[model samples]
Target: MKILFVNTHYFLPQSRGGMANTLDQLCRGLADRGHTPGVLCAFLGSRDMFGLATRARIKVAAMATGIGAAHDAALSYPVWRAWHPVDVLPALAGREQPDIIVAMGGKVVQVIDAARQTGIPLLTQVHDVEFDWHGGDFAHIADVPVVANSQFTADAYRTAFGVDAQVIYPFMPLDQYRTDTHRRVVTFVNPLLRKGFRLGVEIAALCPELPFHFVGAIPDVDETGRELDRGMLALPNLTVEPFRGDMRDVYAQTRVLLAPSQWNEAYGRVINEAQVSGIPVLASTRGGIPEAAQDGGILLPADAPAERWATALRRMWNDETLYADLCAKAVHSASRPQLQAETQLDQHECALEAAINDHRAAHLSGCQLPA
Candidate 1:
C-alpha cells in the first residue's frame, strides 16, 4: 500500500523522542515490507526537512507554514501557527494516491483536508492527553482510527472526546538498547532537578555511598535544560551529561535507572530503554510511569519521602540476589523483538504496515462519530 505519514514538523519523526522515533521506525519498517511510505513535514528552525533521513524512506517535502513550536505548552491558537497539511497538497499532486495517512497529534489537522479530498483513510497515533484535554472539536479533524501509545492516553480520549481509542504502545528498536549484563551504576536520563530531584537529591544525599549519574539535557527546550544545570551545579554525586541517543553502554554501567519525573507522563521511553538495557528501575509513581514500569521495578508512591528512595536503593545494593532478579525481569519486559528493527529498512516496513492498517480501519464504516 502507498502510505503518507505526516508530522506537523520534522523535529519529531526523528530519533530524538519516542513519538518521532516510533514513526520513523514504523515508516521505515513499512517500506521494507514493500509498501511505499512517504513523509510530509514542515521546514522549521534550522532543520533540513528534506534531509537524507527523511529522504531515504519516502519522498520528503516541507510546507511553508509549520506547526506549533516543537515543545510548546499545549494546543493553542497560534501554537500551530499557520501550519496545516493542506499546503502539502500541491506538492503531493499526482503522487501515488495514498491508501492511508497516519499522524500523531495536532499535526493531523494538517492533512484532514487532503484526506477528505482524496477519500484516503486516516489513522492518528495519540502519544499524550492533548486530544482529550482539548475536547471533541479535535476529533472532527480525522475520519480514521485513533491509537494511543498507552492506556492513559486511550482513557483520556474516551473521557474527553467520547471516542474509544485502541491501545498500541509505541515500538522501540530494542537492538539499539540490547545489553549483555547488568552493571552497578544508578542512572537518570534527561535529568531536570526541579521536576523531581528535590526529592532525588535528598535521596542521593541520604545514601552518599551510591553513584548517581544524570544523562541528557532538557532536549528541545533550552531554558528548562539550563535551569536544570544551574540547580545541579552544587551537587557532586550527581554527574550531568548532555543528551545522548544511545544509552545502552550507559545502562551497562548502571544497575538501576531512576525516573523521578514530576510531570504527567503519558508513557516514558526511558523506562523501556532502561529495561531493555537490563537495568532495574526505581521511580516515582506518577502519571503513566507505573504502566511503563509494569512489574519490572520498585515504584515509590507520589508523596513518599525522599528517604524512602534512599532505603530502596540501599536494600537493592545489599541484596545482590534480589537486585539480580529485578534485572532479569527488566530484560524480559523490554526484550520484545517484534518491535525493534536493526536496519532502517526493517523499521519502515513495520511502521508503514501499521500506519496503513490504522488508516483503513480506524473509523466507523460510515465515517460517523461514535454515538
Candidate 2:
C-alpha cells in the first residue's frame, strides 16, 4: 500500500521530538514492510543554502499554517495550509497517487481536505485533544477515520466527537540504550519554553543537591536561558544546561527523568525515553503520562501542588526499593510489543487494513464520501 504522511511540523532529518521522529520511524517501518510512504512538512528554518536560495525561501514560506494566540497553540490553523493544495503534498500525490493520507495532528487539517478533494481517504492520528482549539474547527473535516496515540487521547477524541478511534501508542527503539548507563543527575527533554520545562525547573530547584539537566533547543533560550541560568545557578544546586549535542549522552548520565508538566503535554516522550534508559520517572498525571507509564514509574496527580511534588521527590530519592521497583517496571513496560517497531507496525497495518476495508464497505452502501 502507498501512504502519504502529512506532518505540519518540521519533518527535516534533524528535527527533534515525537512528531518528527514518529514520522521518520513510521515511514521507514512501513517501507520495510513493502508499503511506500512519503512525508510532507512545513519548513521552519533554513541552513547551508548559499546556492539554494529559492528552495530555502519556498521551504520557509510553506511552513506557516496558522496564527498562534493560545498558550498551547500547535492546534491552531493547520500549519501546512500555506503549502497545501498546490505545494509539496499535491506534487507528490499527483505523481504517486497514494492509497491513503495519514495526518498526525490538527496542523495538517488542510492536508486532509486537499487529499479528500483528490478523492483519497484520510486517516487522522489525534495526538491530543482537539477541543483544545484546532479540534473543533477540524471536526468539520471529520470524514476521515482516526487513530489515537493512547486511550487517554482516544477518549478525549470520542468525548469531543461522537466517534472512537483505534489506539496506537507511539513506538520507540530500545536496543540503542541497552549498554549505556552513566548515572548522576535528573533529565528532562522537551522544548524549554513549555510549561513542562518550567515545572521541571521548579522540581530541579526544589531538589538542589541533584543536578537537573534539560536537553532541547528553546526558541527564547538566549534571553530566557540567560535569566534562567542566573536564577538556577544562584541555587548552587541546580544546573540548566541547554540541550545541545546527542541526547544519548544526556540519558546515559541521568539517574532519574523528571516531567513535572502542568499543561499541554499530550504524552511525555521523556517518560518513555527514561524507561528505555533504565531510569525511573516522577511525572505529573497529565494528558497521557499515566496511560503511558502503565505501572512503569511514579505517577503524581496533575494538579498536585508544588509542595507535594517536592515532598514526592524527597520520598522517591530516599526509597531505593521503590526506585528500583519503578525502574524494573519501566523496563518491563518497554519490553511490551506495543512500544516496539515491528510489533507496532503490525498493529498499524492491521488497523489500517481493517479501517480501509470497512470504509470501502461504507462507500459501497453510500454511507461514506465517495472516493
Candidate 3:
C-alpha cells in the first residue's frame, strides 16, 4: 500500500523535532516492509525555511535522487509545504496515488479537508493530548481514526471525548541507539518550561557536583532560546546545547537521561532512546513516560520537590550497584520485543489497513465505526 503522511509541523518531514523523527522512521520502515510511504509537509519551517544554502541543499538532493532512484522514493520524497494543504492535497494525492493518508503531526483540519476533497482514508496519530475541542482542532475529528502514541493519551481521549483510540507506541529501532562512546554527562533533552526546564534547573542547583547537559530540540542560538535558557546558564554545573539533526552525539555523553516533563507527554521518546544505550532514566511518572521507562526508569512524582530530584540524581551518581542494575534494566527495557520498530511498525500497518477499510465502509454506508 502507498501511504502518504500529512504532517503540518514546521520541523517535520525532515526530522529536526522528535515527532518528525518518529514519522520519518515510520515512512522508511513502511518502505522496508514492501509498502511505499511518503511525507507531505509545509515549507515554512521555523528556521532555514528558504535559506539560500538550505534551498540549494534541497534542490541538489532532488536533482541527485530525482525520483524512485532509492527504495520508496516513488513518492519522489516530496519536500513541499502548502499554505493551504486542502487546496493541494487532491493534486498531490492524484499524482502519488497513495492507498491511504495518515496524519501524525498536530493538524486535523487538513486531514478533514482531505477526506472531503479526495475521499482518501484518514488515520491520525495523537502525538499529544496537548490540544482540545476548544482548540478548534478536535471538534471535527469525531469520525477520524485515532492512534494514540501511548495508553495514557488514549485514556485521556476516552475520558474527554469518549473516543476509544488505538495505542501504537512510537516506532524506534533500539539497536541503532547503542553507542560505544563514553557515557558520563547527566543529560536532559528539550528544556522548555512545560517540558520542566525549571524543575531541571532546581535539580541542577541542588546537585552542584554533577554535570548536567540540557539537549535542545531546536537551535537555541536565537534570542528566544538564549532568554529561555538563562536559568540553566546561571548554574555553573549545567550546559545547554542546541539541536543537531543526529542525537547519537548527545546520547554518547549521557550517563543518565533526565526527563522532568511538567506537562503530560503523549510519549517520552527520549526515555526509550536513552534505554537503548543501557542508560537509566530519571523521569517524572507522568503520561506515557512510565510505559516507556518501565523498570529501567528511576521515576518520581511530577510534583516532587527539587530536593527529591537532587537526591535521586546524587544516588544515581554515587550508587554504583544501583546504577549498574539500572543499566541492565535499561537495556532490557529497550530490547523488549514490543518496543522494537518492526513490532510497532507491524501494528501501525495493521491499524492503517483497518482504518482504510473502516473509512471505506463508513463513507459508503454513513455508519459510525465500532468503538
Candidate 4:
C-alpha cells in the first residue's frame, strides 16, 4: 500500500520526542514490508530533528512557507501556522493518489479538507491530549478512522468526544537497545516539571551516594530566560546532559530509568525504551505509563510523595535480588510478542487495509460516511 503521512510538526530525524521516533519507525517498517511510505510536513527550520538527511525508504514533501522560528513561537497554536502550507496536501494527494492517508500531530483540522477532497481513506493518529487545540475534534471528520497510541488516550477520546478509536501502541526499535552493559547511574530524560523533574531532584538528594543523570533541558524559559531549575542544578549527585535523539548510549550506562511524569502522558515511550535495554523503570501511574511499564518495573501514584519515590529508588538500588528480578522482568516485558515491532506493524497494516475497504464499501453503497 502507498501510505502518506501528513504531519503538522517537522518530522526531523534529530527530534528527541516520542512522536517523531514512532513515525520514523512506522515509515521504516512500512518500507521494509515492501509498502511505499511518504511524509508531507511543513518546514519548521533549516535543520531536521535527527541531524541527518531523510532516509531513502521514506519520501518527503516539505512545504516551505518562509515562516521561521520567531513566527512559530509567537503563535498560540504553532501547528495551525502550517495550515496554509498544508493546503497543498490535496494537490499532492491528487498526483500521488496514495492508498491511505495518515494525519498525525493533531493536524487533522488542516488535513481534513484535503483528505475529504481526495476521497482517500484517512486515519488520524492521536499522539497526545491537546484540549485547547481541539485535537479530539478529528473524531468529527467523516470516514476518518482515529488511532490512539494507547488505551488511556482512546478512553479520553471516547469520554470527551464520544469517539471510539482503535488502540495501536507506538512501535520501538528493540534491537538497537539490546545491551548487556549496565552502569550504576540512574537516568532521567527531559527534566521538565511535567516529567517529574522535582521528584527526580528529590530522589537524587535522598540517594546522595548514588549518581543521577538528568538529560535534556526544559524547552520553555522563565521571564528571566532561565531554563534550568536552580534546585535541580544544586544537587551534587545530579549530572545534567543535553537532549539527543537516540538514547542507547545513555541507556548503556544507566542502571535504572526514571519517568516520574506528573502529566497524563499518552504513552511513555521512555519506559519501553528502558525496558528494551534491560533497565527497569520507576514511572508514575500517569495515563498509559503503567500500561507501558507493565510488569517490568514499579508504578507509583502520580501524586506519590518524594519520600515514596526515594524509598523505591533506594530499595531498587540496594537490594541486589530485587534489582536483578526487575531487570529480568524488563527484558521479558520488552521481548513480549505483543510489543514486538513486527506485531505493531502487522496491526497497523491490517487497520489501514480495513479502513480502505470500509471506505470503498461505503462509496459503493452510496452511504454517507459516519460522523
lDDT of all predictions: 0.62, 0.65, 0.75, 0.74
Better of 1 and 2 by TM-score: 2
- Stretches of model 3 off by over 4 angstroms after superposition: 12-15, 45-76, 133-139, 217-234, 363-371
For each candidate in turn, the TM-score is 0.73, 0.81, 0.84, 0.84
Q: Which window of ten consecutive residues has the lowest lDDT sum in model 1? A: 73-82
Cα misplacement distance, residue 53 of candidate 2 (Å): 5.9
Query: Positional deviation of 202 in candidate 3, in angstroms?
Result: 2.2
Tens digits of per-residue lDDT for model 2, 1-371: 87767766654333576666666667767777888766656544335452144244454554542221111113211222223332456555665577877777556566676666666666888776645445236677666788888888777777777667888887555564443777677767773554455566567667777776666664445434454543543556555565543567778887777776666566766567668767878887878888777787777876777668777777767788987887789888777777887888988897777757766777789866659
Q: Tell me how far the alpha carbon of residue 24 in candidate 2 is from the true structure, in angstroms, after superposition.
A: 1.1
Can you tell me which runs of candidate 2 are displaced by over 4 Å?
47-88, 130-136, 191-193, 219-236, 240-246, 362-371
The model with the greatest lDDT is 3
Worst 10 residues of 2 by lDDT: 68-77
User: Global lDDT for candidate 3?
Assistant: 0.75
Q: Relative to the unseen true structure, what is the Cα RMSD of model 2? A: 6.6
Residue-level lDDT tens digits of model 3 in 197-218: 7788888888888998988852
Candidate 4 residue lDDT tens string, 1-371: 99878876764433456787787778878888989877766544434432222221112324243322112222111111232435667776776688998888746766765677888888888888765553335546734678889899999888977778888888777886676656679999877778887778888898889899988875455445667557556777888888665678888889889999888889888887888877999889988898788888888997988889989988888899999999889988888776788899998998899889988987889976689
Candidate 1: stretches off by over 4 Å: 9-15, 42-44, 47-96, 106-115, 132-136, 141-143, 192-202, 219-231, 335-371
Better of 2 and 4 by lDDT: 4
| Candidate order, lDDT descending | 3, 4, 2, 1
Please identify model 4 stretches exceeding 4 Å from their true place.
Answer: 47-85, 134-136, 222-231, 367-371
